[model samples]
Target: MEAAISTLITEFKKYAGKDGSSSTLSKDEFQSLVSSQLSHFVKNASDPGTIDQLMGSLDENNDGELTFTEFWQLIGKVACQQGCFSQ
Candidate 1:
């Protein structure tokens, strides 16, 4: 659990830093991260429209960037969809 959490943090920081802000993920950064790391989990990862829609839905504050909290929502959603929390 600890390692998993750490990896998530590390991955987030890795991509988040690509656009100068280490705390938020720009659209391109998010797209790159999704394509490179979440291709299997995110459908249509290669589609720009799909990525835009996903990013819009996840960008709760409408800031055009995804904070760690917003990014975590994606992780939670994916985990739930994958039955990671199923008993």
Candidate 2:
């Protein structure tokens, strides 16, 4: 679990650093991250419109970028859907 958490942080940073911010993910960075890292977990992961919609949903402040916490929401949701935390 600790390793997984560390990997997640590492992965997030890897992509999040693609742009100038190094703190949030722009649409393109998010798309790249999802398509490459989360393809198996998210359907139509590389579709532009799908990524657009997902970005809209995750951009809590409508800033057109996703902070770490916002991105974590998707991870948590996917994990729950996959029954990773089932009792």
Number of clashing residue pairs, candidate 2: 0
Query: What residue pairs are clashing in model 1?
Result: none
Residue-pair clashes per prediction, in order, are: 0, 0
TM-score of candidate 2 on Cα atoms, chains taken together: 0.93
lDDT of 1 at 4: 95
For model 2, give the RMSD to the true fold. 2.0
lDDT of each structure?
Answer: 0.93, 0.92
Candidate 2, residues 1-87, lDDT tens digits: the string is 999999999999999999879989999999999999999998999999999988888888999999999999999878987887752
User: Clashing residue pairs in candidate 2, if any?
Assistant: none
- For model 2, state the Cα shift of residue 12 in Å: 0.6
The residue-by-residue lDDT of candidate 1 on 4-87, one tens digit each, is 999999999999998778999999999999999999999999899999999999999999999999999999998888986752
